[model samples]
Target: MTIATELASPSPSAAAASSASSADSASGAAPAVPPLLVPKGEYPRPDLDRSERWQSLNGEWDFSSIDGEARITVPFAWETPASGIERTWLEAATYRRALAVPASWADARVVLCFGAVHHRATVSIDGVVVGTHVGGYTSFEFDVTSHLTAGRDAVLEVAVESPADKRSIVHGKQRSIPRDDYDGVSFTPTSGIWQSVWVEARGRTYARSVTLRGDSLKGIDVAVELAGDAPAGAAVRTRVLGEGAAPAAGVATDARAESATDAAGGLHPVDAELRLTADAAGRASGRLEIGSPQLWSPADPHLYRVEVIVGEGAGADRVVATTGLRSLEWNDGGLRLNGDRLYLRGVLDQGYWPETGLTAPSDEALLADLDLARELGYTMVRKHLKLEEPRWLHRADELGMLVWAEPAAPSRFSPEAAALFEDQLEPMVRRDGNHPSIVVWGLYNEEWGLDWDIPGSRRRAEAAAHAYDTMAALDHTRPLVENSGWAHVKSDLVDWHYYEPDPATWAENVRDLATGVREAFPVKLGPDFVVDKSLYGSDEFPRTGVPLLNSEYGEGYTSLERAWHLRWQTQELRRHDRYSGYVYTELADVEHENAGLLDADRRRKDWGGLRPADVNADTVLVVDLVPRAAGADIEVPLEAFELTVRVSHHGADAVAGRVEAAWIAAGAPLPASPHGEASSAAVPAVSPFVLGAPVTLTIEPPAASARLALFFVDETDAVRARSYLDAAPVEAPNRRGARPAPTPAP
Candidate 1:
């Protein structure tokens, strides 16, 4: 049934639409499901997409879980509905399927790759054990070249064990018991294969992996790791996807025309003949110089698509990756991107979904989350406690969103646990090291896998320090947080969390950190929580110039509070010279933690009557709310007041605009439109604002509650930036506390 076919290539827009058609067809009022009933086809790694040479192992597989025996989808975990086995809290599962080895791959070394498998997975093909992997977050592969019989079907079997309550395995937010944690941060557990799996056919000598790096002054530096026999004169060639008026040689004309790249692609291709000496360890390094380098920033995420070709023509193995040229450094009490002092306005993203658990139903779902963060004007996202799929990271880089990647943690510490973590760390670092979006590697969070009851325990500190050193050994480019929040041992940065809602109290805490007076912020810890004084002190075990951040903060009771709290807190943090940055509690509400600016489904929240857009802006117009008297009722006084305004641009680009301010009472007669006097000012990008002898605003709080609003608009009157604060009639707790809702955001 072999046939030769020449199909017309699809246009860029048509191709994009066609790719999205599958997910769009399957998605409905409910969360999306993969369209393919047999679910395989799409290339797993877009970064190294060699579509013609790879085969997907997704589709249907014979599955057996504790509940019963049934068929399940390959990539979706057994717990998700899309897997055709909606069982949660899974203990173990066995998957079996017959795989066909394409005759085309007979001469090449066949490699089986698993994007990720939960907890533990043991693989066997045709009754022979092939390999075994233990971590749930990192990808693993096995060379099955010798085991494959040329013209026969191969039986592939995978046995997976994932106990939700296992203390030795790294599981992020995956709860053993339902809603186990006090604050409701814990979530439903996932088990079995939860990501793509495939087979790659490569030549005898092939490229194992590629690492790309670049800066303003230097050309693209590429490091290629090879596998198998080394050729006598193997060479590494680097080519920018599309460079000059003429397309690159050997590249597909259609691909060169439609692929993502700079306007004219990248600089011309450059090849370096590797010095593979008698004892040369399978490694090749080279550089591709571009005369005119385009810098990457949040405002303009310019990317250069690079193609790394190993060996000679026809037999050469080719892989592509998108890279950005930029420099980052941490010094002088702040972070610098491309030598510009930057502040990270980020939200904690858990990467969870109502229907799919940790697995995003589709690529669009992942993009939607990043797009929502962009709309909220957040420059970064702290991927808290979860090792997300590479596609998610790729999207962040494409969208110009910065990321703080964290590894999932186990419940308790042990020798076995440490060994498993160490085994997983190397792959994690190498797999993601090439990403430009990731700036920090968060080693441990709140000491989840280190120690439970000990504060500054020698054993725990040593463990944290060891982990830090190990990570540094693997990746020296990114900043490392030894342990986030408390109990920091050896790290490039240290941070602490506080959930205080009052702006004044937040300001007071900031002053304490600025003056080097370390003290704990009193807040309610769970019943299982223990008092750890040393962990709370900033000065006790401090490093000389490590930047301090209020990394985690703000849990508001209402939507109004959520928006107001973030605005005021961010302003306060930036006002001080000592603090580096801040990441709010979350981007969207998760389970019972209703402290997000957006609700569970990523919708606008009004507390009872507020718009999400009002509190979110790329370039915000900050106004000083009138301070209450010393004895004022534990609430912001609802009275007429005068305030000053400052224009601040929080994005990576400067903005020039007309500023407008107004106060609108909830029940007052409506005016034709917002009528306010305007002034012009140029707002520089990030951190420090243009504080032009603040314009005073005189407004009267209505007979009831009201909204004080400020907006900065461009020449066309389109709002470039905006902010709003709520005025309440009386001091009262939020109408409701945290409640889990499955409804999508409005």
Candidate 2:
């Protein structure tokens, strides 16, 4: 959390006149031009304390083609509209920009930062090499303090080369296609400064890195690292803020801190704490306490905020960070959070934007996801191998959305691929570890990493397992999901995949193989195709006593209207009592996978007829049990009008159960088991019941219906199974509206 406030010192807009041709600008035309999209919005990092004086170099920059006869936009690759260049490929490109340094920065150290650059990038200022950085997901900075001239403008240039198909780097889901196979979509690779670029001034000694850890029993511990030279008696102070206006502060001696002096004098380590307090705002505070703290449960999430101040002997800068305090433990029972059994109602989130592809439409678009999850009764989301921008995590923390962060794995597992995965994944975790929303680290998905039966596959699995263990050991605060969907080895949780409509089929399989074998089984089933099941369970589950969970289900692509469909389907399925919980196929659609609850544009489909349960006071008929003794009776309540009940029994003697109906308000005893068959003792206004165990009952109130309880009983009162029929208000069909459409196959 770095906070840098600067007075509005207007600079020349990127839209200023340039000599480049329009064909090379973000908007491709006759004259190639430069990208004019400046980074004027608030910088993403507000938690970090930064200087007030700064400038953005993100907009238009001078450009020249590195290869061939094509010319393109400065920052945007030749392939995107925002770049004003639509060339499909760029083997090499050079970008240049000029900025006038203010006389105020003459005596101050100057630093240049690039939000992101694809593949490899080299930076040069005034034709002198300054710095270089690899990898596209992380940010890099260079201290250009020595290359500054007072009141004189500086020329900054960058050379970029990216073969989007290269497997050596972490490209996430970017694809490479034949030259002529381009589709009219924004799925092409984005290169070079897709994010903001700015310059900030730092004090002689500044805080480098901060790591915050919390233990439920021992409270929170803060570790801070500082950079640059520190005086002998330097001290670092940290403050904790929440609902209270004032913050609590803690001080530590700089002499005891571990310094990254050899490596650019960056701070490597510094530890402080705030005990749990009742005044903490829980999830509302944007911060919380640790000791005996209200743990961050899926049902009720809580987070804490930490502020760090670095003083050189006495005068230092300050930074702020928001984090959640909780712990994850893996035992024979399964994954547990805060010492409680945790069930992951998760969705595979594919971070994609219809307009910007990997880039989000806006910060609001990111926050909308968490809000949607809360509405749908989900608490967790798997990032699905893609690392998101930091702002995404910030929203997750604020919305209390738990995250399973996975590193993108190569399609094939080669020795080189393994090295690449390790290289990129380690830094990703270290950079994102501070966020409380990230609870699980997923190593591999399915067979993405290695061949299941190959000789070397075992070693790969072992190495992956060891890597998972190492991450857990490094920060035991979160659980490690060794492999997701398939390929379970020596891991903590047993994860599996199934793609069948019948949930009971897989449930029985697990029962026969694990519990029936009577052997020690630590594997927990992670069903991938459970969302499509119509009947969650069958007769086999009652006999086998197998415990099953709905790990994956409901992946229908989201549309505005589909929201109603989801509510309808969810209500219909919960009555079965077979699934533990459901993890929908996806949170957002990525590429061609349209099975997302949200569209690529991040807009919710309009569900016209169906309303949120809260807004519409419609009562649903929930039948707890279907069949009982013929002489026994059932009970139902009136809430909504629609009623449908299915009864099934185990015995051949259908006469064992009976349904005797009664209207409690009218004081009239009605006939038992209405509909299907006629009985000898028939009461007025009551339908008869059949001798069969499973009898279908349909009750349509004849216009005059009251808020009354309907009771069904047998002679002995032994068959006490009940069904509830709620009275629903009549809904008028919308003749002006379109007809109801059929639900699409998931």
Candidate 3:
């Protein structure tokens, strides 16, 4: 048998580190006492779901802690209240559960899988140790067939250790003691088994892992890694499931199909077999071609399911995988999806809830965030710092949202820290690479872990360059970012974080953005800050034609000013041909970061007259009449003003929309007919959303400051489907903080 039955021995230093982590956990503070049982027993990997041959090991488990033995939930962390043991940082804990193997799999190989353990864990079945793993964010497995007696009660035990100090490992936002790099952005730490645990029964020759890639429209590449050697003359059978089928049970058919469907009506995706004679490395790979493939996009997220089966008859093992066909590239100095120039109207999603800490309350709870994003008109999300659950990524695919997958940044830099950073980065990309929604792989964020002493230091630059090269090699299917904030070191995209709240100052800054940002860094971040003064050899910015994006901006106190700021910032970014898109600071308030469009409890913040559809739309209409003086009178006499209205489309889908504007006195009702005076030329939807000829509307203002309401109505009669722009007087500080329009209660 090729599968090893013994657990790998730990090195002397690793053993010492484990002991130290245990000691730290014992000395740390305890979290609120979680309940005795709060189960998350669902199948962990829905992307490759195999529930028929699997059993959830999630409910109650006998746990032993510093406070003594107690019953705790299997998936919820020990520190989370849901686990019934609210202990913040615990030393070493042992979890024991009882289960009986299915009678039909008496001689089959049984594997136990854990989605994620906090830091480290050792697993044993019955009484023999089976396997061990040392990462908190990646999934791990153990072969437990030999340790179990079939059709009988078997005891499964796991010992987990989580270090109190985050510096001990590559702990991402989890904090016990706050540091400069972590402070307000970091959150409370969680420990123990924080993800699902389950068991799978498979044949002797099972498929261990499958890596899917490439766009489905052209052809998809598939590689399967096997466990144990294939018997003589045995071949590996692969098939892609027809739409609407359960992911695991792919339609059975011939080796390959000439059309999209077979005679039996099963999907005819590239079905083929690999002869074991050429499998020297226990790996098989091939390409799949499908006719009339559906492309995946934020508006239409379509996924294709595939299955790889090894062996034959009752002893066969099947592995399922889901993927979508979509190409994401930065070419001709702009971002494109499926060869169409597209702008990413996105928001930064922190992936934190007030009660769950790191984990969401349920799968639906996570889906609610996506639903909220779509409702707010955001096409994409930058999943900041934390790596979310796979189901969350799947939901993004189902809901038509794009994701920029970011690695969790460590707080400090050291030799061990560097090792940990590279160690986890590869698995993160490999595991999530098949998902079409993840278009970009983010290496580090704003230099959180690699913060060196000197600005533009060689050490920092070298480190970033190395990380970029390393991540690029693993997954060449998506764009790679070295450092997101100010420093640009060999990255596909150069992103910036500008939080200037004043509209006029912001306008001045954007006037000379490329240069003003370069010079303002040292002063903005202080002298000792760590940032590169040049990108490669370019003194101002990267001259490699890399796309530019304002990854973060916006912090206004009042509803009126915030709305205006969002509109102004988005409009300004759109003006620059080189600027691909912009992602606002956040979608919702996370803990103390109150700059979200929605508050901490997921409540909508009144954004004056602006709705989500207004801020994030493929087609937008902006009325730039020029700002009035800062201290202008509250009331103005009726006067004629030249309003230059610009109508532009951000997507490649050219649309026919009519523009209509009307002047209404303050507090006066709008006309019910929904008609206007002037007709707008057809707005072509393409890369540069700017209009060639601006529609100069001569507005005869009323006695008071009149509200100029403009609408970009589509061919359809749906008004909300179109974007509306309401021009109003900017408010002062005291006028800020007005209660936002009431939303359906959260």
Model 2 TM-score, 2 decimals: 0.63
Q: How accurate locally is residue 329 in candidate 2, as Cα lDDT from 0 to 100?
A: 67
Error of 3 at 328 (Å): 2.4
- Overall lDDT per candidate, in order of appearance: 0.66, 0.48, 0.66
Cα lDDT of model 1 by residue, 179-242, tens digit: 3342246776778898888877665556777777775435677777876445334666667665
TM-score of each: 0.82, 0.63, 0.83
Better of 2 and 3 by TM-score: 3
lDDT score of residue 623 within candidate 3: 55
For model 2, residues 1-746, the per-residue Cα lDDT tens digits are: 01111212112121111211211332321121122234333445543424234565655666667544433333344456656555556756777777554543443445676656766778888888776766665566675655645346678877777674544344555554431111221246666556556775543344556666655534556655554334233355554554322322232212212231223354322223332211111111112233355555445556665665555322244456656667776654345567654555566676666555555545576667777766645677777666776667777876778887876655455667666666655456545777777877777665454533222355666656666776666666665655555444434444444433323343344343333342222222232312221111112212233223334444123453234234333333333333323355666666676666656765554433232322111112223333211111223333323333323221212323344332332222222334322222321221111112223344434333322233333445443333222223444455887878899999
Give the residue spans of candidate 2 off by over 4 A: 1-40, 47-56, 66-78, 99-111, 149-152, 177-187, 230-234, 242-302, 313-315, 451-456, 501-582, 606-746
Please list all clashing residue pairs in model 1, or write none if there are none: 38-59, 603-745
Q: Write candidate 3's Cα lDDT for 528-574 as tens digits.
A: 55343332322544564777777878757665556657776776665
Worst 10 residues of 1 by lDDT: 1-10
Task: Indicate the worst ten consecutive residues by lDDT in candidate 3.
Answer: 27-36
Leading candidate by TM-score = 3
Off by over 4 Å in 3: 1-38, 178-180, 229-234, 244-278, 452-455, 514-541, 558-561, 625-638, 653-658, 663-674, 677-692, 703-706, 713-746
